[model samples]
Target: MHENIDPAICPVCGGDNGCALLAGQPIEQCWCMRTRIPKEVLSAIPAERRGKACVCQACAAGSAPARPD
Candidate 1:
């Protein structure tokens, strides 16, 4: 596993993943539980980060990469 992996962050874009489960909410309450994260989008995340953190909605929806900030 990658060091310092934060489940609250997006593994792909390094942004806030907004995972309800990470926020102490039920797993069923997480948006990811209801949404279908595309295979291509999931493939974008680095191997070290995959499954370590949640991908953000934008990344999961294939609408974002690294955001300008």
Candidate 2:
């Protein structure tokens, strides 16, 4: 799956200064290869935009794990 994203823009935060994990990359080569993103944060993304988008480190880091209610 290839995410036709702006090379350096974050969809959630709208920041355009760094690289997001492009869609069609090998899992091992993807930018998200190292850090672990929270499932809650991933799910919060709108359905139509999931997998087709990539979040920046700042944004990912900002999404602290959700607490149980």
Candidate 3:
């Protein structure tokens, strides 16, 4: 499997943003995290686990693991 890592800077606030969202929350609860995932990798995630796995904007922009779509 792949190991996910968060970004050093927050894509939104441009600050030291760390991993805050969990692996199973509503998309609306963390829109920034979901938007960070790449289309290709997002597709790779299982449909059933999409909502369970999500990454913050910092991680997404950094090309980290994204929530499944």
Candidate 4:
């Protein structure tokens, strides 16, 4: 996504879900529903932003590494 894209973009990869659910499909059909996002990785997000955005595929799938401190 370009600048001025979703601020809710993943803090890890700065990307969006682009999933069917996000496109107005059922939650059960969303890929994230089947995926397991690591708790430690989720903890890296700032408290204020927690639960505010969905981490992209890479972060959710553990492909992308932790963001530097």
For each candidate, what TM-score against the reference? 0.85, 0.53, 0.31, 0.68
Which regions of candidate 1 fall more than 4 Å away from where they truly are?
Answer: 67-69
Clashes found in each candidate (C-alpha, N, C closer than 3 A): 0, 0, 1, 0
lDDT of 3 by residue, 1-69 (tens): 763433433333334434444435564665564564677544554544354444345455654543332
Residue 31 in model 3: lDDT:
58
lDDT tens digits by residue: candidate 2, 10-45 = 555545424433445566765667878777566665
Which rank order by lDDT, best down to worst?
A: 1, 4, 2, 3
List ranges where model 4 is wrong by over 4 Å. 1-8, 65-69
Tell me the deviation in Å of residue 43 in model 2: 1.5
Task: State the weakest 10-residue window (summed lDDT) of model 2.
Answer: 16-25
Clashing pairs in 1: none
Highest lDDT against the true fold, candidate: 1
Error of 3 at 16 (Å): 18
Residue lDDT tens for model 4, 2-68: 3333444777666665566557889788777888889977877766556667777788777876655
